[model samples]
Target: MTFRRQVMIILRRDLRIEGRSGEAIFVTVPFGLVALFLIPLALPLDIELLARIGPGMFWSVTLLFGMFITFRQSAAESSSQQEQLRMLGVDPAARFVGRAIASALLLLIFELILAPTMVVLYAPAAIPGWPAIIPLALLAAVGLAMIGTLAADITASLRSRSALAPLLVAPLSVPLLVPAAQGLESLRTKNGIMVPTMFMVAVVLALAVAGVVTAQPLEETT
Candidate 1:
């Protein structure tokens, strides 16, 4: 098969699996909802307070929830079937790209739900600039997907890989977390899409490049 075909195969496989399951809708997104619901309660019910901090809190929780699903997505990439893919001569790099793309798309959907959910729950005053928010969110979702998929392989062989996935992925994801939170916060503010947006895009691009370069070795090592 051609390289694009290989990537699409994995992408379709992962997307189809997610569509059939709705695990995010029923499970992880609710976990994010809990985080969203709690922040306002824990902080104060003050509208002003919520408006100030809600964007940051929303993105942080969304990332956490996204990472949770990311582990599951990468875990599915393994087993006899994955070995079979390799045996068939699908480039390991292509497989990574494909899986990352699928996982990124999955994460993207998950975030799309969580964003509005946050707005509903928190009711922040400075409405997010939808134009900037879309790309910012896309970056955050895909960046998390790439980073998490690559990290998942580190502990894939371990019996404890599920538990270990977060531990492995979280530190590396600090760059994503910082810029994402800041960008969302900025996007919600009057200045709109400026420095933080650029920072976030830069970080996502860096992670994408790094993940692509390292994906094969990481897969092999695990």
Candidate 2:
């Protein structure tokens, strides 16, 4: 099959599984929302303080919860299933892209649901650059998805993957979390978001390239 076709096929298959299972929406998303909701309760009831720190909290929870989605995507496919794909001539790069795209779409939905909740609970002051949040969220989702995919693949064969995957993903994802948190704070404070925003874009591109290039080798090793 053509690379594009392979990617589409894999994407459709993963999405279909997620649609039937509702793991991302029904399971991961609720826990993420609960985490978001609890942050305010843990902090002093300072509305201004909550508003100031809310974006950072949102990104932090997203990164934590998103790891589960990516790990599950990689772990759901059995050895037999992977061998079946190889037998059917699926390109490793295409498989990686397809899975990453699916994870990104799911993470985007998670972020969308959390964003308004953050706003409602924290009541961050309105700012002129509010619209910029859309792209920031997109960039963050793609970056996290790519990080999680690569991490999952690296630990796919390990018995301790559930513990190790987060270790691998968390440090690598600092670039994504820091910029996303800072970008929103900058917007709230009326500071320009160019630097952090561009940094996040660059990180996402780098992770994408790394994920595609390592797909074949990672598949072989696992």
Which candidate's lDDT is highest? 2
Weakest ten-residue segment in model 1 by summed lDDT? 70-79
lDDT of 2 at 85: 91
Q: Give the TM-score (vs. native) of candidate 2.
A: 0.94
Q: What's the distance in Å from true for residue 200, model 1? A: 2.5
- Estimate candidate 1's RMSD in Å: 2.4
lDDT of 1 by residue, 1-222 (tens): 898999898788877787788775567777887888877777755887787777788778867777877777433655788679878988877877887887787787778787788777767775545566677777888888888777766666678877788887778777777876776556555666677668877887887788778867765633
What are the per-residue Cα lDDT tens digits for candidate 2 across 91-193?
Answer: 9999999999999999998988988898898887777857886788899899888898888777876898889999999988889888887876787677888
**Candidate 2 wrong stretches, greater than 4 Å:** 73-75, 188-190
Model 2 accuracy (lDDT, Cα):
0.85
Evaluate all candidate structures by whole-model CA lDDT and list the values in order.
0.75, 0.85
